[model samples]
Structures are given as structure tokens and as C-alpha cells.
Target: MKYLTIFSLLAFITLFSSSCDNDFNINDDWADITVVYGLLDPAADTNWIRVQRAYLGEAAASASYGEPDSVYYDTTAISVYLEAYSRGADGSLGTPVNTIFLKPDFTSRKLDDGIYSTDDFRLYRTTETIEEDKTYKLVVEKSNAKHPEASSITEIVGIQQSSNSGFRFVLPNPNVIAARTFNGNLKWYQSDQAEIYEVDVYFYYKEVNRQTGAVEHLVQKLDYTTIEGAQIPADPFETIDVDGSPNNIYTLLASNLPELKPNTLRFFKSFTVIIWAGGEDLAKYIDLNRPTEGVNNSKPEFPDIENGTGLFSSRTSIMLDEVAMSQQMATTYYLSSTLCEKGFAIVTSGDTCYCERIPGIGPERVCD
Candidate 1:
């Protein structure tokens, strides 16, 4: 499910325009420049690629942006396909495994309303499963032979079970007591072809309105940590670690969550962990295109597709849900003197003990 917005496409145009001439020109010689953006994910049921043409005409670029002909090719005008190749012992591409022809998709996914035409929003797609161990090459050929075919090769970010590098939560185990002083390493195995990783943690809870007896489920997310440009180890099963502290979770909750209302009772539900991995090429593209500061505002181009502009890479994400803390840890933290002030409670043996504050008085526990 990789797609691009009109703004990204415009940025690509700007990047190519800058590389071609010192001064911006609205009326340059007509050239056939294909724009392609795709990210292969082994976990996805279907993969999609966005293909479009960059236009430079005598008239203003913005004036023609709304015209379908200016940004998109006719369905029959181009053919898109993916070639699979296995890597040899020497790291060279082996014989072709298979070729996957992509069909033009016009209606599965909709585009947001913008300056660009949406009448026939197009994307090329294939339902074939992408293999994590194989290399993929995307090729786009135009009916007009004068235009050179655009192509790019990438390796899929491998985190599937078959790859023997499936992501797993190593620390803060389901039964671990996550006390306030708990300090451990949040760890997971690195995937092949992955260079960048991002982890997010979600905290789920239920809030009950004491006055109305209404319950509301709530969740808060924390961008726990990120590992960028990690060099892949010779061993594909290498594990990576980041600081994991229970105090950090408490601090994040205190800072982001709203203070409890006088008549509210909150109960801790569970936690969820999500990790995202980006392929090496995608990481390089992101690094090269990131904004620069000071007098050097120009950025280096990162178009991977030959004879065209835009990115073609790989990315994948995994989620571990229903992560739980030991009952002792849950009560020690959620019902502690500090967090209890925020109307936290615990349910045990069909009974509930919640914190309550009376007017002109300190906090007290009320059991029901």
C-alpha cells in the first residue's frame, strides 16, 4: 500500500528541474520523463506502483496540472512489470525466477482532491506474493519506443517467519513487573535488507464516569525509539537493543494524558508494540532528501529509477498486541501514590478500588 501525494510529485519535479538547469524555466524542450514511486512489502497481499509522466510545456506547469493528460498516461500507453531474481553466492543476480505483469488500477484506491486531476487516478498493481529473499526489479515500458524504459531494483525488507528473522519483543515480557525503577533493554532481531527501524508503544485503558456509570475506552501512543542507518551484521539473526525504562512510560503518560476528572475512574487495560523496518535503499533516499539548513539548502537527488525520477524501495511493519505487565507491577504503578492521584484503579475478584478526592481533603480509596 505505497502511494504518493501530489506534493511529493511536485517536489520530484523541482528536484529534477534544479538538476537540469541553473535557472527555473517553464518552457523547456519537451522531454519524456517518467515518474515512479513504489515500495515493496513482503507482508502485503497486493503491491502497487504509481506511474506518471512529468510535463514541461510553454504554458505554466500549474495551469496544466489539473488536466489528466498532463500528469497521467493512458491505460494502454504503458506496461508495468516486476522481475524476480535470486542472488548468487557471489552476490550477483541469478537467473530470472518469474515476471509479474502489473495491471492498471483505476478504482481500487481513491486519491484526495487536489490540483491534480482525479477523474482517472491510476496505479499499477499485482496480487503475487513478494518473496523476502529475492531481488525485485520494476520496469515501466512506454508504447512509444522513443522513450527509454524506466527500471529500478530493490531487495525486500525481510521480517517474515520463513526468513527466520521475525520480529519479537524481548524485554518487558508479558509477565514482567514493570516497576517505576525498572530499567531494561527493549530488543528485537534485525531483518535482512533493513537499515532503519522505528518502534511505537500504545497504552490502552478504560475510563468510567462515576456519576453516569458510562465507560469509555481510550488509548495513547508513544514514539518509543528509532534506530537509523544500522549496519547489517554478517549474521542475519543479530539482535538490536534500545533503552527501555518504565519511568519513561510513566513520564510520557503524565505529560500527554489529560488529568482525571473528579468523577472518573480509569483502569489499565494493556499495551501494544509496533515496529517498522525500512530497506537500505529507502533509508538512503530518506537521508539524501532530508532538508538541509543554513546557507546550504540544496539537497542531493535520490531518484533510483534509471531514466526516470522518484523512489522504488521496500518497507514492512509488525505489531505485537495484548502485551501485559505482571499484576504486582500493574498495581504498583497504576495505583501508586503518584499515578493514583489521576483517578487510577484496579479490578480484582469482581471488586474495584479507585482513588477519590473530597473537597478540602486529600485522596482516599473507595471500593465497590
Candidate 2:
């Protein structure tokens, strides 16, 4: 198994540096070996019990998810995560070094089970210079298939030059550069104190079709203890410039989303992104009425592969600001154009490994 993780990480860096104070520490506890002798928690069915917190990257936001009515808002995905670490030296788990992966815009990269949190372990984000108290470590791993591989549930917080909770943020959280690539651009991650809040973005187009693999998404009913009273927005916040500024980017309107009738080139490629940082003074604005921008533009059911069979996909919702350190406020949603390779066998592309075969083959490996 990869030379047993390189000989147990070279016998733990040759027995903890061999001499430096002849010391040894990193036993946040739990380690019995299974992947050839790992640590943290490893009884070895695969691993279980995940969901931890403790993070505070401050602020940065965005959102988008169409049709709050007529059904479609599950926001699916979010099984395990909280692997942030700043120091723990060896307690294993939680090792991104500086750490930061909160994800917003509804968490679209799969793993959005609502920002995930079982409890404790959350150094989530914090590193301007790294001083404060030092400590650092928040690890929790489960879900490879999830069965009981155990290990990873360690927390050792510290660092508070100015921290009331875990503090750190940033990831592909701002992604939406362009799904089908028409008029797109939505990026977030700029928080000094989060100053101004009044951001709301939502776009939708699900139920495409790729011959009929069957698909239709978006039913995120709204939970997490009512999501901070259903999304802040009483008005009184405003600090997110994007710097390159211009308009922020908004364009879509087939009569402002006539239930999404695109001409199909891939107009909406099964999408999702619902963000409302602090909410915008709520008079009730979730794309106003919703269809996702449009004035002269056009493409909903349009072009979907000439207009049929694509398997549909979409989700993006972000309402950040729990400040980590633990839980109480978290929601993630992100799932971009994934035919995942329509069951694998006839075709799958994105540069191979969509995987399936092995029935007889010597090795053609062929699969788009």
C-alpha cells in the first residue's frame, strides 16, 4: 500500500527527529494500525463518525439556487470534513498546514452535508502570522465508503491574538466562472471584518437530459436551526467589492426564468449556487421572481444538447458566518455539471478514470 505510506512516514521522521530534545508528541490518542498501521482512530472497517468544527475565516460570500417553490432545493452532499490544522506536530489528521476549506456558494464540489459538524475539532481558519497561543489541530475523517476505519477526532485549539472561535476561510468557494460558459463570473473570499452584507445570488436550470439517465435537483428546504432566522437581511451591511468591479455579473432572462426553457447548448448545465451572506435588507429578493438574469440573452431549454437528453444537474447556496470554532451555522451546496460519466461503459470524459470495466480486458483502459 504505497510502501506502507512510505514506511510509516519514515518511521515518523526517524522517530521524531531522533534527537531534538529527544522528544515525542502527537498522540492526540487513538492509533491501532490498519492501513499498515495508521493512527487517530483505526479499527478499520473504513472509518466513521465525522463532522467537526472550529473555524473563522471571517467573512466572504455569495449565493444562487432557483425556484424556492415548485420543488427543487435538496442541496445534497456533505458527509465528512474538518481537516484543518495549524500545528499538532504529529497528532495526525487535520493537516492542511495553514488550513481553510469552508466552501460557500452552496458547497458544489460534493461534501456539502450542510458544512458538516459532529462537534469539537475545528481550527477551521486563522493565520495572519500565526502567533496568539499556537496549539492548532482539528481532524476528523470518515466516509471513503464509511464503515469504521476510525481514527481522527483530535482538537487542540489555541491562537487568539483576536479569536472568539476558529478562524480561517477560502477554497474554490467562489467558483462559477462559467458552467456552460456564457455570461458568468461569481467569486468570493474577501473578508476583513466582512463589513458590508447585502449579497444575494441565485441561478437555476436543472432537469436537462442525456438520453434519460434521469435527473432533477434543488430542494434544500432550509434547516440548520432555521438558518439564522431564515437569512439575516434586515439591511445594514455592505463590504464586498471584488476590486476589478464593474457589475459583478448578471445575465439571464427567458422572461426571467419561464420555468427554464433554454435553447440548449448546455445552457444551465444542471446548476446551483444560493448565497445570502447577511442577506440584503430582505423585502424578499431571491432573484426577485427568478429565472436567472436575461434581457437580450436566451438559452434555457434552448440548445440542453440541441434540446434533450443530458441528465441535468445544479446547486449552489451560501449563507456563511458561523465563525467556526464549532457549529450552529453552516450550509454548503455545490454540484457542477456532472454526468459523472453516465454509469460508465460506453463513454465518459474529462480525461479517463470515470471507471467501470474489468470484465475480461487485458487493458485498453479506453473511456472518455
Candidate 3:
């Protein structure tokens, strides 16, 4: 599965270019810099890592980026693997568990057209199940003796649980009424080894074709919030809340939903919440790479991988589905002046209320 951390590699290139002045040399001696990017997740059946070399020459870096040979190393030139270690009760690494070797994966997924070479793109992957109770160390070995090996270690983000109650919505439930005025809170049990958290809220609905009588289910996502530098609590039962305002949901729907169509009828359904937690190394990497402001904009480099200029971390996600809306909130979609014109309909207690405009009358609300 594709992970969001993959974009960090692109951001790294952008940041490097912006930091360079016009006087900087474009044709400097090539440095044997290996770029490593990986995110381990215990929930995934497989994990993949991207390993590439930084190139420099007479040509502009952008010009060479699209060339397969310029950015990618031959498959046989490098070896990648992970060494598992037992994590002790005191949070210290114990004896080695097992080593998992990764093979170059050319299929499974395709690369999008970009500045990077998409023709020969590849990723190293392993199907071995990742365990949450252990720590994983990534090791990248190069056949070229001149380049040093790149390595980094990370612990899984969340603890293993039998139930799906690890993450939950604490406020604005039973129905999200007056979302603009509703204070929202998303709570989750403190996940082990998690340093940063991100929450996403999705609004689901159905659109019926006025002519064909066919229905299409659709969903719109709103990035609720991100919580950084979170500390694991002493009590496992203790929870952490990510603050948010539901009013944004209304605004998001109003702005993003397609323009009202005369041949379409829209009905609001339910909401889903997804939470993501990142390991300490991943959190630190993001923190260090964030855009700087003010007169002094210089930032320190954050290459968590040893003998390389990239990151190897861990992340996991949890989802809560089908959170129902309150009856009043459902009614508001059809009655509210701001949303009624958007062709919203409400269905509650076996009754349906559709808001629409009549040619002779100004506007009309019909119930069936």
C-alpha cells in the first residue's frame, strides 16, 4: 500500500533547491549520497522502502532527474533488509530476533509522471509480518565499496488490540448539529511509540440521478487537525484529544460539493474518522523540514538514516466508520437557508424532505 511519507523525498529535493543561491555551482563533484525513504507499519501485510542515489553533473539536476540511470541504482548493485530486535520492558533494544531481506519490486504499483524517472522506478519490499512487540532496524548495503551502508531503527506506532476501540470520537456525536458552533474533540488511547498524530474526517452522501433513478455514493474528506510532540501517558487507559471545530465541516461541504444540478438529488448520510500516528523519527523529520519564517529562514538537516541523507521511520492508522448524524442535524440540511439551495434532502422516521425551487414560487420544501 502507498503511504504518505513517500512525498517527503520530493519535499527534500525542493527544500535543497530553494536553499541554494544563484552563485552555487551546478556541476560539483558527485557526493556518494544515498537517499533512503521507508515507513514500517505492523498493520500492513507488506512494507516497501525506496532507495536511490543523489546525482550531480554538468547538466541541471532537474534535467537528469527524469533519466532512469541518473536517479536509480542497478537492482544487483545494492541489498536491503531489516533486522528485528526484541524491545525490552525498559524500552531498550534486546538480542536480535530475525533478519528480513527485501527484494526490488517493479510491479504492484506504478509511479506517477513527475520530474523523477517513472520508467525504471522501483521499491524494495518484504512480505514478512511486522510485529508491534519488537523494534526494526533497516539496513541498506551497497556493492560499491566507496559508499557506506545506510541504516536506521524504529518501533511500531500502536499497541496490538483485540477490539477496534483504540481511536474514537468524543464530542459532536449522536448528530453533528450546528457544526459551525459545535466544539469537537477526537480522542484515542495513547499509542505506544507514537510521537505525532493526524486526524481526517470524511462526510459521506448519496446522489440520485433525477432521470435514470440511479444512486451514487460519494465522500468528501476534511483534514481535521494534527497533534505533534505527543507524549505517551503512564496510564494506558488515558486518552488524548485532538481539538477541532465542526463548523469547518459545513464550510468544507459548501465549498467542495459540486454545484447543485437540476437532474440530481443529494442526501447526507454519515461521517467517518481516520487517525494516523507516526514514530518518533518520522515526527522529528517532519518538524525539521517544515518551512521556516521570519528574517532567518535557515533550518538544520534531518537525515535520520546513518551514512545517508534520508529517513526510515514507522506509522500506523485507525478508522472509525458510520458515525450517524443527529435527527436535528439531518433536518437542518433540508431546512437551513444556507444549505437548502444546495439541493440537500433529509430522510428520518420513514419521511423524506427535499428542498428545491419552484418556477412560480420563490423556493419550496416538499416532504413525502
Candidate 4:
């Protein structure tokens, strides 16, 4: 999920506000200047939109946003909404398919108070299905204001699936023993509108009670590896590279599982691969918010919103779960000299031996 913390951005703006003092000159009349943030994704059942007012001056800027109600708006005073536009049967643009109000929902949020806020941050939410090949716009308005305080638009271009749809497994090749080690790459074809990609592997396993000789299925889902915020330029047609090293995979299991105990036994289960991707707006938002490239120390202006500040974007993720280990590889967890040395527990189900780790992998079982 994308976090839209304005306190940090406010602090950052404060740091550079002096240099660009004239850009944010506060009027004595205290006319409201709104700050908005939201990232839309069809994959999510509930979408969130965060709205806050921009503050200025040394004293207000330095104040911790963690304090209750310091950086949020009154639900009665503000209204947030979303509009979806899609093409019709004729393939020509038509009227908005839907216009929905984002309802208020409050939950404890760790925000940036120059550090980060830990209070309940208020947000507007909707269950609208943000569809593919559609355009979405967000509008925020104050009850007393004549016009929307903030507004932004984003295009929802769906992510293009790879030939294998991002989950490709490297099964044990009959001729290559080494094939038993490597878990193939998690790959995807980039969307024409996507600019950032993330890949991760989840290894799931179980722990056992040696004393009772009872099995505890689904103990942990270890994040074996992650490739975060990878930049992909040009048309995203070719396959993308994700970590697929066997050594690292073993190391992760060994480190998490640790030394075997007489009181416990663990078993290896299935593994999952996930690919998270973001659209062009998210990429631009990242570039604008990510640390500066050089010593220049200036911040880039955010461009998506109009007559206001912050971001409006879209994202999506794909997952492949319960991928089974090759028989050769599963067997090695117990009998292979190389894998046995890693401290993985050897457990038996009937007559078959499977490797297990502890602390453990997310409580999801890997198939034997």
C-alpha cells in the first residue's frame, strides 16, 4: 500500500520553504489551502483518500502532527469523491460510468509528526471497483467553499500480463542437479503505463511438536527476498529480472528456522511469488518524493494535482502461491549434505522426509 504522509512532506517543504518562500506565502486572511493524497487500484476492495490542510510558519510547521487532530479535518466540513469514466461499446469516450462519495473512516495511523503520526488518521474510503481502461478523478470540497478545494485525475491502464503471467518456476531438470537449487524468477511484462515494479518470494512452512509427535501445519510465510521499486523504462514487453538465487533462499530458511530442537520439528511447505506494480503517476510521485539525487538539496514540484498539493495515482499486484518444491529439492532438505548443514529440521509424514524451518515462515503450508 502507498502511504500518503503529509507531515514529512510538510517538513520537507518547510526545509525548502525558506528558499522558495514566495511560492507558499500565507495570506493574512487564512484562506484554506488543501493537501490531498490517494492511490487508486482496482485490485483493492477498499480505496482510501487522505485529505489535510496545508500549514505554514515556523511554529506551526515545527509542531508535532502526532498530537490528536493536529493535521486532520472535521468530517462535517469536508467531502471527498471519485468519478470513473470509461469508453463505450462504440470505443468512443462516454459519460462518467459512476460518481461516488468517499465515506469517512477513522483508524489509528502512524503519520509524520516531523517524525511520524501515531494518532487515528481520518480517511475517506470507497468500495467502487476502479476498472481497467478507465480514468478516475478525485474531488475534495469544503462545505462553505464555492469550488473544490483540491482535484486530480489519473488513468487506470491495466498491467499487462507476462506469457507466464509473472509466475515462472524452474522445476528440477533431469540432467542438472543444480536445477534442484534454483527457484525460477518471478517475472512480468511491464504495462505501458507502469513505471515501478516490485517482486517478492514468500516461503511457507510448518513446525512440529516433537514431544507429542503432533504436527503443526502452517507456521510461517518468510519473505525470502524482495526487489522493491525497480525502475523499468521503455515498453514493458521483455521479461523483468527478479532474485532467484538458491543460496539466498537456503540462507533465509536456515536463518529463520535456526538450530533444530529436541522439543520441536518443522516442515517445509509451499512457496509463493508476487509482483506489485504501479502506474506512471506513482512513478512520478516517487521521483518527486524520493531523496534528491545530488547535493543541490532542492525538492521537485509534484505535478498531478491542480490548484492544490499532493498525489493521485494507481497500483496493482499479482500473486502465485503454493508452488511445490521439486522432489529432488524436497528430498535434499533431509538427505543432501549441502542442505542438511543449513540447520533445517528434518520431519517425517508417513515415510517421506520434508525440510522445515521455524519462527517461522508465514503460517502457510508448502506442498510436499
What's model 2's TM-score? Answer: 0.17
When 1 and 3 are scored with TM-score, the better candidate is 3
Worst 10 residues of 3 by lDDT: 174-183
Error of 2 at 325 (Å): 35
The segments of candidate 1 whose C-alpha lies over 4 angstroms from its true place after superposition are 1-26, 160-167, 172-185, 230-235, 254-263, 326-329, 335-344, 348-368
Higher-scoring candidate on TM-score, 2 or 4: 4
lDDT of 4 by residue, 1-368 (tens): 12457777877888886777656645464446678888887778888888877654445644755544556777888788987887678765567778989988776344455454646578788887777668887888779766456788887646443333432333322235444333543444555456676556666666677468777655444564433354453444465555465556666565665565565555677776666667777877776777777779888677777767888888777666656675555655443333554334544475434343434442222333
For model 1, residues 15-108, the per-residue Cα lDDT tens digits are: 9988888866657678888899999999899999999989887767788978898889887888999999998999998777999999999989
Candidate 2 runs further than 4 Å off: 1-136, 139-200, 203-239, 243-249, 252-368
For residues 1-368, what per-residue lDDT tens digits would candidate 3 score against the true structure?
Answer: 24557688778888888888557665767677778999998888899999988788886568887689777888888899999998778978777789999999888879878778787789999899888877899988889888888888887775564133444434434245444222345667667777888878788899988789889998888777788753445555667765544455666677777787667778877787778888888989888888887899888778587888788988988776677655455556565545657778766678767876767764577877
Q: Each candidate: what lDDT?
A: 0.79, 0.27, 0.76, 0.63
**C-alpha lDDT of residue 336 in model 1:** 46
* Candidate 3 colliding pairs, count: 4
Model 3: what TM-score?
0.78
- Identify the superior model by lDDT, candidate 1 or candidate 3: 1
Best-performing candidate as measured by TM-score: 3
Collision pairs in model 1: none
**Model 2: residue 243 alpha-carbon error in angstroms:** 6.2
* Per-residue error (Å), model 1, residue 181: 16
- Model 4: ten consecutive residues of lowest lDDT: 166-175
C-alpha displacement of 171 in model 4, angstroms? 9.9
Give the clash count for model 2: 98
Per-residue error (Å), model 4, residue 280: 1.5
Q: Between candidates 2 and 3, which one is better according to TM-score?
A: 3
